[model samples]
Target: MNYENKSFSIKSWAEDDRPREKLLLKGKSALSDAELIAILIGSGSRSESAVDLSKRILNSIDNNINKLGKLSVLDLQKFKGIGEAKAISIITAIELGRRRRLEGALELSKIASSQEVFNIMQPIIGELQHEEFWIIYLNNSNKVLLKEQSSKGGLTGTLVDVRLVFKKAIELFSTGIILCHNHPSGKLQPSNADKLITSKLKSAGDTLDIKVLDHLIITENAYFSFADENLM
Candidate 1:
């Protein structure tokens, strides 16, 4: 029970008691948060095992992973054995976990209206500092077949290739397509360039027999819909 004087290594422990072996035998979900962090950190200072050091680090944040995520490398270095590499390992793991949660939470398969499209795509692109053009390809039931980034550009504008948009629609056998892009300036009003592109894409969609559902100009707080404005 006196751990301060012992320089324990995880590999010296029983196989079932080791973080890596336990994970392989019982699955990652069976490991505690500190155990996972132990695997990332790999080693500890002369006085502790990696798991003990990890537990101390986690306890310093009161087991709040959110607070731990906000920690810089310098902040993590306050822990006796956590160096820059170990700090980056913990930070990268936290980031990947955050993105995985977003992937699960952001599913909107059905495209019912411009509002629904806005709800689905807004969280992904609305607050961006640059322009990004996205296409939502839909099946006959208006269920989304796929969503893809068609183009990315500077703060002012993005160049969306009409041919590339329709090509993806054809490949997916999509019956309807929704066009979307963000305005970094937070302006909901569509510009002349916006109207021109909408007209051009609508015309192309008509020839291919794929319905152009709408073109949406999105901002963090609001959006302008070409279909709602009778521009489509």
Candidate 2:
């Protein structure tokens, strides 16, 4: 029989022929996003199948294979089969379900210990894609007043300026500052450059009469505190 003569109706096909029935008979993990979406879309136009359209969309996203976040309606409106209404439905539906992880830095509790501050900060800045240095400005009572990204780029002993630290501390009226940075490698071990930079900041803080409380090395999973180890 010629392939062109074959029937295309999904109902006329076998139990194994349908994506939905295959998922029900097997399990959900066995189905690709395209297969799953084919079920939601029901059927396709004469020119294209539902599965194909879904494949195009999933592929356009670089096959992320996870829940789509920030896949804007505007981004999807450019796709062939997806109109504004469909794109809006998808984006709004996804956003409604997302309870974004809030690593609360705005809590009223004053950070008493270096370790306590390290724990709170580890979740936010530790897992960043790029190297960024942050300063936590502390009030006279050692409570956090402002958290700001001090610099953005590679961190070396000579690259960081102590003036920037004092400038920010003065602007925030902070009596002390906690310096922190993330290790893209997740090592949590301070380098020779890190030590040199800290020593310079300590001297500057002494001259400026602003306390340099601690320097923290943050990794995605953990943190190393200079004060905790008596390095500060």
Candidate 3:
């Protein structure tokens, strides 16, 4: 009954309650977020189970996986049971998931609506900590020809080179383009600077005969569309 030195390892749990065993018995989809993350870390400290440690980590971020993904290795290492290797494992898994989403988004070849543009660009820039200006070039039929990052800057804003944007459009024979950028602050409202850049790009597109199809202010879970609001 000397409980002070007792171990609370995952191996001590019932097979059904163990993360790895449960994953093998049930399915990957059956596991909770903590269970999945426990499997990534593989083990826990002598006094806690992996799942328990994972729950504490998740609790710190209010169980927001997007917020979890934003954490750096040093950030994760601050957890009691997490070290450099385990932190790297978590970061790697999150990055792979992000890339998978990007691949899925790219499968949509045609852009028919503002929603489609959001679907395509959100995975690329939505959860970023800083700002990035992007352009989606489209052929005459609205099929995507290319998507490129136009600029990168701090949390406030990024500069878009209007001339370079059209230069690429002309080179690709793109007749239409969509402008997209992320607000790390999660604000959907277009700032005065946002409106100014949209107007600049729209006017430049007009002179070049390359239509500005839409301008999207992307956030983690939502977007603001200038075209949808009659601001185009």
Candidate 4:
């Protein structure tokens, strides 16, 4: 054992200061979101501290942890020294945290009203740069069955997969679903394609005994609910 060779590993912080060690000693409640992220990031670039980078990221979103998770991969790339691999690592970690949070609360049928949909969606919706379609499957009692991602796409937008959407409904034994997507354009108004696709999905739902409750278009600061305005 060459004792002199152990000087320059990434874990320069003392055991008390190490995020994981602190968590072990003090429990998870002792760690802030940035501290947790610093643990994930492991180390910083030459001049920046991992905690500082995490703080900068959090501050960019007005100190909202949930909001930062939704930031686009491209948007994250804007930070200096964050290359593609690091960007993916950051995005994937946030996504896993979200899914973990949703694991116990993904009851579809219990949720009602566009506001409920908005609340569940704000995290995923806020960070998107392009369009993404999510299907909120609800049981006969309107309790959430599951939240499944239907599709993702570019400026032209996601193509709704009617067959796959129904497949998930069948798996969850859902009686209804809510269609949700984001408008990167910041205009909550549904596009012509948006309208056309909604009509198609609604018609399909009718045939399959699955109801189409609403289609919500969320923006950076606003949202539109089809059911709220009787669009569906």
Instruction: Tell me which of candidates 3 and 4 scores higher on TM-score.
Output: 3
Model 3 bad stretches (over 4 Å):
none
Tell me model 4's lDDT, rounded to 2 decimals: 0.81
* Candidate 1 clashes between residue pairs 3 or more apart in a chain or in different chains: none
TM-score of candidate 1 on Cα atoms, chains taken together: 0.58
Candidate 3 per-residue lDDT over residues 45-162, each given as its tens digit: 8788899999999999999999999999999999998999999999999999998988898888788999988888888899989999999999999999999999999989899889
Q: Judged by lDDT, which candidate is best?
A: 3
For model 4, residues 1-232, the per-residue Cα lDDT tens digits are 6645544333786888778889999999999887887777676676676777778888888988667776777988787656677778888987887777445444443786888788688667645788899999888888876777899988558898888888888888889999999887788788999999899999999999999999999876678999999999
Q: Which scores higher on lDDT, 2 or 4? A: 4
**After superposition, candidate 2 runs with Cα above 4 Å error:** 1-103, 154-158
Better of 1 and 4 by TM-score: 4
lDDT comparison, 3 vs 4, better candidate: 3
* Candidate 2 residue pairs in clash (backbone atoms < 3 Å): none
Question: lDDT for every model?
Answer: 0.87, 0.72, 0.94, 0.81
Q: After superposition, how far is residue 54 of candidate 3 from its true place, in Å?
A: 0.0
What tens digits encode model 2's per-residue C-alpha lDDT throughout 1-232?
7656553444555778578898888988888877776665555544566677778878877865332444667777677767776667666545443323223544645878766776667656665656777888898898888888777775332256678779888888889988888887768789897888888888898888889899888876678888888998
Model 4 alpha-carbon miss at residue 130, Å: 1.5
